[model samples]
Target: MNMERRGFPVWSIVAIVLIILGAITAGLSIETVPEGSRGVVTKWGKVTGRTLGPGMNFLNPIGVDVISVNVRTRKFEQIEEAATKDQQDVQATVVVAYHPEPQRVGQIYTDHGLDYEAKLVTPGVTESIKVATAHYSAEQLVTQRAQASDEISKIITAKLAANGIIADSVNLINYQFSADYTKAIEDKVAAEQLAKTEEMRVRIVTAQAEQAVVAAKGEAEAIALMAKALADAPDVLKLKQIEMMREKWDGIMPRVVGADGMSLLMTTGE
Candidate 1:
């Protein structure tokens, strides 16, 4: 018996080639989105308005593309110079922390495209700062930097939300004013402190004067009371004089002069 062997048929070879090509296309069509990212699917340069979550995703192998969108928190920093309510120039670096809405990335890409930070977040932060700064004067902005940051964040959050972006936080990293303005503020604060010191000194002096007046009045009243007591009891004076004599007398007769200029003799009491 003789065994016959033949090479692979031409049709089978073509079929294998086609199958390899198909496998390659299929591999290319599947996308693996990393953590903290989402996908926006588009067909023929038009968004399908479908969003994909993290992990592996499959799509049609032909004419369909998936764009990866970073849903993680991002930051955009810009220096904005705006006028306060008092028409004072304020320059600050505004840092905005934001992320695309994971569920709305498709809408975000469709409305604002991939450069949404420049188109939306940056402008949103700038305008929000401008508007929020207008609500306060230059002095207020400096004194209430934290409050200004909060207000700007609120404004930016609302503004961006409508466009499918989430503004996490807004921070006024650095705030500045004109040198002359800062000097003026310092001088004004010094003057206010000086004025307060003067007022305190005046109050102290006034209190001292009042205390002195009360002390003098008290002394005068004491003197008046003594005089009244002495007048009401003239015998008290005689008793006091007697006590003085008793303290000073010796055991001998004494000579005294009367008010009428007459000499008188007095004997010490036994």
Candidate 2:
């Protein structure tokens, strides 16, 4: 009886073994969580509410999933145009610093989904900027730019934290005003500078005029004192005239012709 062995073929056994090895290989693979990251594990597309830290971790081969959340600081920027309190349009470039809370990673993912950037972050930043900017006039916003940024940061930090997100800081990168408004501000500043310059010029001229008047008065006073001294001693005039002639002639003798044509000799040296 050519009874073929009813046992399974050797090739079939080998195929079964290969399939089992493949399943084991897939299940034994390790997923790596990078530094500054938190891993979230989900089972059957539902979050398991468990967070894993950085390193290699094992998850279910077919039914479990692992997602990495960035725990390090992150930055987001947006350029937005909105109306100020005075109904003037302004363009503001804003930057936000934030990081996902590691403990709340699963909840954040579940609530905001994987696209939290579009769902939560963008809207939060937009609302924060709008609300804070709406409280200031365009002029004040321009002048007190730092204060406006601080206000926006505070509002965003508070609001975002309440929703399980941590914001490190918010910055107002730049602000742009309408061309007409910018020109108006520039004109006003130029006018103020010109007025200041004119005032400074007037002050300088007034000071110079006062100094000149004082100098003239001092000279007149000195002359009057000399005249009074000469009057107190009548001979002082003759002595002053002799001193003046000595200075002018440099110790030389002079010949004076009088009104009757008589010559007189004047000796300057003793």
Clashes of each: 0, 0
In model 1, the number of clashes is 0
Cα deviation at 163, candidate 2, in Å, is 3.6
The most accurate candidate by TM-score is: 1
lDDT of 1 by residue, 1-270 (tens): 122236667777788999999887764667788889888888898998888888988777578888898889997889999899999998989887899889998888888888988898888878888999999998778778788878887888899998888988777788789999988877877898899999999999999999999999999999999999999999998899989988997956777999999979985564
Give one digit per residue, the lDDT tens place, for model 2 in 79-134: 98888999888889988888877888899998987677787788888888789889
TM-score of 2: 0.70
Q: After TM-score superposition, what is the CA distance of residue 19 in candidate 2 from its true location, in Å?
A: 17
For residue 22, model 2's alpha carbon misses the true position, in angstroms, by 15
Clashing pairs in 2: none
Global Cα lDDT for candidate 1: 0.86
TM-score of 1: 0.74
